[model samples]
Target: MGHLFSNYYEAVSVILFGIGFTTLLLNRNMIKKIMGFNIMDTAIYLFLAAKGYIFNRKVPIVTGEVPTPEQYINPIPAGLVLTGIVVSVSVTAVMLSLTIRLYRRYHTLDIDEITRLVKEEK
Candidate 1:
């Protein structure tokens, strides 16, 4: 019970990931799909960062005094997550721009409608 309470973030992240997957799988709106993708990306980032974290740890840096590995938290996972967030933002921006273009052309954000219109045009 205590461990479960302590690791609630993991549980929330899993729920978010599942919701995002469901949205991605079932949603018809392009914007909603993008939002779902963002949710999934965020959940993954949260889960990874949470996994990498340690209780009662300091930042990873060597001081004048000799430091043991256990004294500091590993920086790699945090760095990776930061990079992932940047990439996700860029991807989201590009996806939104594409969605905007699609909406302008078809006057609808529905993926099915867009496909059908494209099919009719071809």
Candidate 2:
């Protein structure tokens, strides 16, 4: 039963990652692409954090009841995920800002259209 649940979680994570990757690759809108990238980052973070979580484990702390970290989930992966989330947010912000600039310069959001216009101008 536990194995089944674990497999399910892994499968779902993989599916999310694949969908996000495909969206990032196929989407033409800059905002959508950014969203897809964020989704991919989130999926990876979730996978990592989930992998660190152990069954029947308490939170990692030095409490009286749980004096040691033997039965607790590891914290390093979660911390890394937090950092990854921050980085992803920063990247998305920069990408969105660039998209806005592109929109302002070209007056269109379509990637192909913008490329054609830039080529024509050149």
Candidate 3:
């Protein structure tokens, strides 16, 4: 649809989210799964940024005249995106560290294999 094309960022974000979700679901490699999750996070950030942007609008700071609400783009989405980035990075670091430990213990990164080995140990 024309509207879909006009809002290309949202469309692209949706497509990226689908790809990430599919990768997360279909891949068995731990690193690939993490990559997929990062992709999804990126898509969400892009979507939020796109939604926060407005044509012909200034940033929220007022320089000379008192600004009306309509004069500036909303700042909340940008703030949310920033917060999400911080959380995403923290989560990624934790995941990678855990994955490293798993690799060390199992000598493999395949989750199914690790599960099987754990069951065998039990």
Candidate 4:
């Protein structure tokens, strides 16, 4: 029980990743695909944050007293996740904008319909 409890965040992250991947693969709507991408991105961020966490450790800030490396939780993963979040938001915005364009031009958000229209055009 304790072992499983300790890894709860990781477990949830894995579940979110699986769900996102499934949605991305199975969904036909462009908006649903974008949502799945966001979900996958959040899962990755959670996994990285969980990996960076340390039991009974302080934040990765140094004080007047000299502190060893292990005195604080590792900061690399957190930093990377922060950057990932920014990039993810930008990507999501772009995807949503493209989806809007597709909807305006194709009159539908369904991937199959859009592809069919494109093929008809050529």
Candidate 5:
């Protein structure tokens, strides 16, 4: 049962990664591109958090039980993922702001149309 649950989490993370990649490739809108990047980031964090869960294992830290290294999964990945999420959030904010600015300047969100307009002006 534990093994099945673990595999399911791993599978979901992999699927998330695949979806993010596909969205990034197929979408032309800047907002969609940023969303895809955020989706990939979320998948990475999910993978890390899943890795931190232990089956039938108590939390690490010596109280009365002898600490067994094998019983606990590393928590560093989870911490790193937290930091990654923060950074990704900041990046998304900046990207969206830029997208808004671009939209205001061009009055259209279509990438191909924007490019054409700029080329014609040049």
Candidate 6:
């Protein structure tokens, strides 16, 4: 549709989210799952950034004379995006560390294998 084309960023983000969600569901490898999660996070960031942007608006900064609210884009989405990036990085770091520990102990990255090994150990 014409509206879909006009908002290409949202469309791309939706497509990326679907790919990431599929990957997350289908992949058994822990690393691949983490990568898929990161992809989903990136898609969210892109969607937020795109939605926050205006065609001909400036950043919400006071440079000279005071301007009306219409002259600048909303800052909340940008702030949310930045916060999301920090949280994503923290989560990724934790996930990677856990994966490394699992690989070291079980000598495998397949989640099903790990679950089986844990069950066998019990």
Best by lDDT: 6
Which has the higher TM-score value, candidate number 5 or candidate number 6? 6
Q: Which regions of candidate 1 fall more than 4 Å away from where they truly are? A: 1-6, 61-66
**Local lDDT at 121 for model 6:** 100
Predicted structure 3: clash tally: 0
Which residue pairs in candidate 1 have backbone atoms (N, alpha carbon, C) closer than 3 angstroms, thus clashing?
A: none
lDDT of each: 0.92, 0.85, 0.93, 0.93, 0.82, 0.95
Better of 1 and 2 by lDDT: 1
Residue-wise lDDT of candidate 4 within 1-122, one digit each (tens)?
88778899998999999888888889999899989989999999999999999999999998899999979999999899999999999999999999999999999999999999999998
Full-model lDDT, candidate 3: 0.93
- Which lDDT tens digits does candidate 1 get at residues 1-122? 88778899898899999999888889999999999999999999999888888889988878799888988877888999999999999999999999999999999999999999999998
Global fold similarity of model 6 (TM-score): 0.91
Q: Score candidate 1 by TM-score against the native.
A: 0.85
What's the lDDT for residue 20 in model 5?
87
User: What is the lDDT ranking, best to worst?
Assistant: 6, 4, 3, 1, 2, 5
> Lowest-scoring 10 consecutive residues by lDDT in candidate 1?
66-75
RMSD of 1: 2.1
- Reference-based TM-score of each model: 0.85, 0.88, 0.89, 0.86, 0.78, 0.91
Lowest summed lDDT across 10 adjacent residues in model 2 is found at 60-69
Clash pairs, candidate 5, are none
**lDDT tens digits, residue span 1-122, model 2:** 78767577676787889988998999888778888898888889878988888989977766767366687889899889999989998988899999999999998888888889999996
Off by over 4 Å in 3: 62-66
Clashing pairs in 6: none
Judge candidate 6 at residue 45 and give its lDDT: 95
